[model samples]
Target: MPRLFLLAAVLAATTAIAAPDNPPVPLPKPPQADRTPAAGPPVPAEKPKEKQAPAAPEPEKEKETAAPAEPPPPPPPPVETEDRAAFEACTAELKSLGAAFRTLPRIDDGNGCGIDKPVAMTRLSAEVAIEPEVTARCETLLQLAHMTRDLIEPAARLGLPDMGRLKAVHQASGYVCRKRNGAETGKISEHARGNAVDISALEFEKGPVPMKIAASEAPDLAAAFQRTLNAAACLYFTTVLSPGSDDAHRDHMHLDVMKRTGGYRYCR
Candidate 1:
């Protein structure tokens, strides 16, 4: 105990001598850490709460997207007009062939039926009269003229030799604006476009005779004439429907200038 008292007095004397001007200050204790984490369940170590920098504020009112432009409209359909050069040329040719025709107003029954330039055919020639007249395009009459002048007249002289010269041709249909075979619905007929003619009967110096009777009874002469007419019509027209071709054409001959692809001619 005496030794400890003496050591203490010596430490005080040394401290006093070392710091005579200033007294020694006591140091403060540091705070202890609570290493024991949250109570309840053990939480995953909160990664040292990362010190994050503040972010820029977002816009309040949203911007709208732009709209796309509209597409262009389609073009109009082609107009149905007569070709001045073609019409004039056809008329000139028809006049030379002894045809009596007058240019008529346009015939447009809409619904896919129209004739740009049509003609009223009074007669093909003096002898080959168009009984009751007919309305057709120039091309049709031209084809008829070619068939009658070259084929019909010659065939009549030889086949119908007993009946005398053919006086006139009785037409049944031309430019009537009806469907094929006169159906309620189907492909538009060639006659609707002024491209066809239906011959119902033929006239001789003797008198008029229905084609049906002439075709069967006069099988030797008159029937030969009908056959010749049908066969020869195919040469001039792209389509020719005769008595035996189908039920629709059994009574009258249907001839048309309807152009087919590859210059194909339909003879039936």
Candidate 2:
């Protein structure tokens, strides 16, 4: 029995020693640290944009327009008078005598001497022309026309054969608004009243022939003719002033028909 027990214990010890070695069990891993989500792909670092300059403003355009037209000048003022009938009668008489004339309105010179029925004589008659025009009274113009046709033309023809006919009489002075003898303060002149005329030259078919009142300057024939003309003018005109009269009469013959208290005629 003892031998049998010893054999059994020996068999158990041998069985334990003959078994293979087993692997050790692994320990559980600590909970992993909280994971952070990865940021989306890194955005490329943005470069700073450059600042641009502002554009310049455009210039304003000018408008095209025409300027307004200017107004016209005013007309001349008319003369005032009340003697229309007398003026019309005088104008008609002048026309009837074949004298070319125009009636002028009254000229009030602010002084005493101003004609009421003045006539501007363009021609004495169809054959006779008044050069440089003459403004005179109706009575004076009529007398002048008669004298020119009768005495002046015939006398001129005798002297100058080439003077086919008397074309014009060059007048030095006519109706003038001035004092006597051109004095500033005095009685008004006959010229101012359109009652006087000054003859300076005579126009013929050829040309103009200036009257030389100085006897020394005139030719022998011309001197005699001038003397004759002066004498004839004295017969027609109440006042006749020639070269020998005064320095004022040295260049022209001044003639007028001024009535005197006595029938006294002044001729020089």
TM per model?
Answer: 0.67, 0.63
- What stretches of model 1 exceed 4 Å from their correct place? 1-80, 213-219
> Could you give candidate 1's per-residue lDDT for residues 1-268 as a string of tens digits?
9999999999999978887576668886554585554379777886888888888787676767677666654432222577889989999998888888899888888755778898999889866789778998888988888888899888888987777787888899988877788898657788778889888888888777666623444647767777778777888999888876787877888888887899999997
For each of the candidates, give the backbone clash count.
Answer: 0, 0
Instruction: In model 1, state the lDDT of residue 13.
Output: 95
Model 2, 187-209: lDDT tens per residue? 66788777799889888888876
- Largest TM-score belongs to which candidate? 1
Clashing pairs in 2: none
Give me the runs in candidate 2 sitting further than 4 Å from their true place.
1-93, 214-219
